[model samples]
Target: MADSDMGELAPSSSMDRRDPDLYIEDGNIVLSAKDNENNTVYFRVHKSTLVKNSPEAFGNMFSVPTPPNMDQYDGVPLVQMPDDAKSLRDFLTILYDPQCIATILKAEDFPKMLRPVELARKYQVDWICKLVASQLQSSWPDSLFQWNIVAREEGDIRAWDAYRTEAPEGDMDEPRGLRCLPEPVSSIILARQCDVPAILPVAFLHLLRFPSEIYDYNEVFPWQIPERSLLSQQDWARLVLARERITRWFTQEGPQPWKDCGTSGMQCQVITLTTWLNIAQEVAVDGNILKLYGRQVKGDICDKCKQKLEDRFYHLSVQFFRNLKHFFQLDE
Candidate 1:
């Protein structure tokens, strides 16, 4: 009933130091930070827009009669929010404008997207949570090339090329012929947090490329990682162990020379074979056998062994991927 009895509230901070992009001059509600230095950080947003996206949460808020002598800034109702200003602003910004995160595949601000997910889940805003989750999920497909192929097969060729062409350009080296989440680690964190299972294998596979130190570090990650976004010990173990098993299997499969047909004297060169092995290992780590075969088929193999080797590699990879579910314990 009193401030002294309510215990310590979490400290408030802003997502942006300067004015947040969402601060409208004539808005209906004021989401004030819990701290005393109030207007230093706040959001001015329309009540109807918030209510539309989050009917249950906002409906309940408006249903209750206004309390006496409640704080109001410039005739707008001031609602105290325990969330830091930045997260609240980002969440409200998306609610006011649905397209805020639509075209951006890479995480311009991962936590900006993630905060909405946390808040959406907290407030039982399923649509808002699903919007953020889908945005996060779009970064990683079940199979990158397979994703394109499926799109094309489904008669959406335009979307296939658009997604392919939309690859984020920068110093980041993405998987060959595949689209990847801008920040795999952050996406993995979001996937687990939101219970978006379809994207987990891809996220975990991409994380294998990172060094072990990246997981638990306190410093800011490149993807704007939220504070203490560590995976459970079981998940970390599962990812690491899966990477090792996949790598080992591919390496062993790599060195074997292809079977010969007497008519054609085509043989893989030692260096070329090594490169093929490396590509196989990469594809296995990436969780796509078809991509591995696609890369291999592009090489200079003679006609006699081409189809045979392709069949062999396909069977091996499919078998491996089948076992992968067991390795990752996906069945459970």
Candidate 2:
């Protein structure tokens, strides 16, 4: 492709330009998207890559002969994309750079993933969707064991508290809390849009811990929270009901953790029970379990007794977490 293919960059008609690095001259096809100011940003990439990566959509699309008078850019077939240039750039980066898969898998690049995931689904890019979903599932928890593992990897989650403050006057800040975790609502929105059911249970559960004022969107935050109206009424009902059940369960049943304890000594049971009662009260008001779970109970007791209490607590946490889909009405 030549610069003249896009036309000489005239001051009056410079809305069309090639992506500096992505415009491969030897590429057989051109993918174009509109930038923020309505400029046309073009990416020249191999036709085989699109077919191989999106067999259901692009592959099927190109299976037929090119119709007469079809659009072209520098003799290459042009495909107009529905995606915006910024997101399309990220999507193309994932498509062109194989090494970037590992980058998106880490917790640090979590927020950068949403647009690509959304674009991948829109274009029926199955592999990218699966990879991003797997990364998301790992970021969340399926059991108390997994939760504790992520917690340790986070290394003193209080350090993330700087992400919270009065909402900025402009767009929300990046990397809000816990390894740039997407606000629960945003995750729920993406999960719903992309049909990633595995993420919904924990995403909904995470939302239960946030302050109710977040629904207003005017609340202070470092991360973006999409408007609550975007969520379906059914989801809202599920969230509300789930919150009630969580509060009830923690209050009525959560504190009595040592009942089946086999410990011969009563000291561990007494101390553990008292600690849980305090935790139960805090959960009633805030329901921020991740933060609460990290609190240290007195360790004066013998190791065996402490181990028994901890085992029982883990079991209960697991039991409750496994029911999140049910509580969120997603089990169906």
Candidate 3:
């Protein structure tokens, strides 16, 4: 708890019992929300802690106004939150638990932090939003080499390894963020909603690597309602342009056989180039590039040629990403 003995809400609500998971036996305030199962979940917490974390959101609410019209159950004031019980629980976990943020930062699943982030923004809780944004911003690779690695490694890479994934675990300069969730398109939609702009470019790129089947049907995503309206017109346009640009890059000026190969035969270079070109073409058409390929190169090619190939690919990929950003008016 950030603050203690600061103030208290009305006590002992028979109608508002303490939540076993969130109740700090002697805490001052009780927060409650209805769960999906239609049960009221209560949280016993300190008003001071909430106030300290989000002054604009909670401070005024907790204060004694000129004429207080408070909501109470069984004599104890109850704060009604708009979020579902699960999201509220996760939001509180981030606020109170020291290890929760660390867990969120490292989790392979992006949805783990999605609900919490939504609640944070809904309530105008700036700190949590900023924390999430920071994690997301740090996840993007700054250098060409790093970007290349991320393009190949995709979701499994650390947010920062050499700012990509292979960097030492102890490195502190780059923290990671959640990878594309549901799919890259969904992840971009989530990012746009959350106001995290840095994630857009890479997310768009990842989305390009998939098939339209993932985005064409509204039922595929749980969010869309009666209308089939997931992506915006601009988003669809960006996807089309990105595909055209990448297709041209692959077919017209694809990776050439690197001359650095020594022990590995030229046949291996051909296979690797062919694979890379295929992925580019597939990505343009919304094909499953990931399913067709994995990170492992095995012993098929020599290390030097592989490095050269990746380096070359990195140059073209970065250029394509920049061009795509321009097409979407996201470069700014």
Candidate 4:
């Protein structure tokens, strides 16, 4: 049947009904009221008309129960629709109906469906994650399986390394943080904490590796190093070079101005350390070492040195794992 024809027969009372207690006033549906001898007669105009014309008012008026005569009724609590219940009903109804389900199943626009799936994947609840997984399993099983395997393996490696390094010396009995959880679990934790879309692979990499290096390398690097340890020596060296390049960029052009001085030397040092720590944390969390290090000092000269801080500083910092390593070593 045609959509309009199908719409005509739908069971929505508001769609079929007319405004009963309202009248047209200046082309607008408005409530009509009369003051009786000792009471107020309050009645709505064409409620359905109001609903169609002024949905906000229509929603407000019929939202609760009232005495038969509007005049007889004193002010009372407005009727309210239970949003959660309505949502549950709508979801279940749409999900269970064969026609609706089939229509969704036949939809060729995968990207449109991707939005909701991504939302479900980001939901904090485990059941929601499972529901998303199940949907993916039924619709795009292969991709879902691949994501699961990769996420799980990566999650496991991260968890093991984190446990070995960050887990307190005598506190093995405590529950693991999100880092040690399954990928989906870790993703949910991160999504909840950060309030973002489903954690992409790159984002996962950043979260797992970069931020720790920024904050306290001695504490976080040991865990990340294990993942690098598996790489061939050549690959490791290349990775180090890439990291150096990024670190140089971050120091030079990153949001924090390294040259700015607060009132006290200690305060300046604290601010610098804290800023670098935060940058490192973000880089680690995103799992993109290159991004963490990619930021370069912005202007031509180090505001302090007046001489151009050469691009070579980028590689040098990586070699020493310190900012402005060349200047400091020369000073010493």
Candidate 5:
């Protein structure tokens, strides 16, 4: 939609089209990318607007002298971009409306943020990159306190689902089964791409909870098979090894009661062993040892025995969580 008399983009060239919203009438530059059908879609936008926001990327790009015989559209210089039109549109939408960042962020789910973050990094948009990265890290459980809160929240979600399902038809609330948990494979890759290694251990732990058989058996080409996983061979191998280690821990260390448990009466000792077995079996099947911490396990045990169990659970959860780095064979 140029200011000139060109009523439609490529009136002659049917293979091309102009983005209705992005093709500003008086814009001085043109951006182009091939759509799925291999047709070039052109966007006319202001160069100064882009440069003003992403100085490092646009400044360097435009600062260079225009090459001889550069592509032109409606007398303005054309610059072909590598990104698809939709993603580029999203980038411009976020870049143009800095004041509406919170609104934009809230509307976007965690996985959807990946595109903007990727585009931000590619275009050297510092503030946008940092903003998205900080948001992603916050959504994940970074510390034990945060992890404990997540555990509680998930428990509540389960309870909520149960309540809605079991309630009378007249009392049933609106349908609610939304879980905003991040996609583990993409989250891990995004962390590596954005250099946020702190979230990796938890992400890896979440991925490990899923049976490897859910994905392709040919682990050698994990990254190539996007339908399965995008992890490199080394990362996949590390997870495989960690699964064995975790299972071994559940069988061995996880069931053992506190060192001083037997010193109590015979009933206390028997109850401790029974409680330990129940917790270990539950975690082993679910592959979520994190339940041991923060949530009190109800059983018929004395206060002293309860304290001992809590202490044991706390220590066990801490050990497994903190050692996640070693389990996944990640470098500190």
Candidate 6:
């Protein structure tokens, strides 16, 4: 038959018409079209039929769901453990297993895991504690004693002697702890170590000192401060003075690269100033007592009633009293 005529034949008729040498192999229809030329044509069953009819055929192929690409997920792709809590837990686990401490310490950017270091100290992981203390001493010579206290408190005593040995002499009475520890780190330590209330004021002070460090100010100190805890007028004035001092310092110092220091750093200073201003306004009361004096001096004339002078203080102060009452209600 002509080559074009082959198209007219049904698949089964064409298969039967092929040379007797034609056969099926591995589920594929293989037909020898020309003996001397060794020309052959092969066709496989439809993919849908193969999957439906033969379980063995599908077994060779993996059917896993595709994993999502890095961009598909949110936030930082690296630094695998999520947030401070997970990082702390993982760090504590590693510290408890001494064998892992050396490996973790050697990792790149190891200091970024300071939370874990603090956690290790808290949990009393000896090896991790020593490693942290050693690293801190080498990196922050000034903070060695402070870090030692951290280590000691955390129960890592192996490096306590090393801490003492390396402690700088002179002014031993002076506190030598981590002066530059960030507010978040300080708050974490306080929450872990001390009562929340005692530490709260300190934490709030830290927030005031380093407003940029706190991400959620509303969460930390809700907008509606308790009436009883509100600063007294005098204290509010003092806070305003302190804010002015900080602002003056910043103004004189010519704006200390606050913008480059990151949002938390900048916000810390802002929150302190803003909070002081807010509290000052909240407590300030206008003490001016309004007086209505008629052209004719009559001490007994009822200021509000304007009828005649009366002996009652209310009568003398009636106009001022009514105004005061209105002011108080508006203030509330």
Best candidate (score: TM-score): 5
Cα-based lDDT for every prediction: 0.58, 0.68, 0.59, 0.35, 0.70, 0.33
Worst 10 residues of 2 by lDDT: 4-13
For 231-276, candidate 4 gives per-residue lDDT tens digits of 3455345344545544455555433334443235444445444655
Cα lDDT tens digits, model 1, 284-304, are 544444344343454565655
**What's the lDDT for residue 287 in model 4?**
23
Ranking by lDDT: 5, 2, 3, 1, 4, 6
lDDT of 2 by residue, 129-206 (tens): 677666667666666666666555455343334444545554454443344245566567656655677878777756
Candidate 2 residue spans exceeding 4 A from truth? 1-13, 152-196, 210-238, 254-281, 288-318
Error of 2 at 290 (Å): 6.6
How many steric clashes between backbone atoms does each model show?
1, 1, 4, 43, 0, 13
Q: Per-candidate TM vs. native? A: 0.61, 0.65, 0.59, 0.21, 0.77, 0.19
- On lDDT, the leading prediction is 5
**Local lDDT at 8 for model 1:** 23
Clashing residue pairs found in predicted model 5 = none
Better of 1 and 2 by lDDT: 2
Model 5: residues with Cα > 4 Å off, grouped in runs: 1-15, 99-101, 169-181, 210-234, 254-286, 294-307
Q: What is the lDDT for 21 in model 5?
A: 80
Q: Residue 264's C-alpha lDDT in candidate 2?
A: 48
Q: After superposition, how far is residue 297 of candidate 5 from its true place, in Å?
A: 5.5
Please provide, for model 6 over 1-332, each residue's C-alpha lDDT reduced to its tens digit, 9 standing for 90 to 100: 21242222232233323222212233221211222233322222223332332234232221333233421111111112222433444453453355565664443223344556555444444444556444433332132233334323323333343454467864234333422323333332333332222233222222233333334423222211222233345534533444444344323322222333333544544543443344334223212111111212232222332222122222323433333323222212
- lDDT score of model 4? 0.35
Give the per-residue lDDT digits (tens) of candidate 3, residues 1-332: 11123223443333534566787766776788777776677887778778887777788787765234456543455677777888988888777884777766654245576777787777677766666666665665544455655544443333233353455666555435423333355456556766787778766655555444554433222221211155678777877776675566556656665556767667777777776766665556752222332244434777776666656555555565556565445776
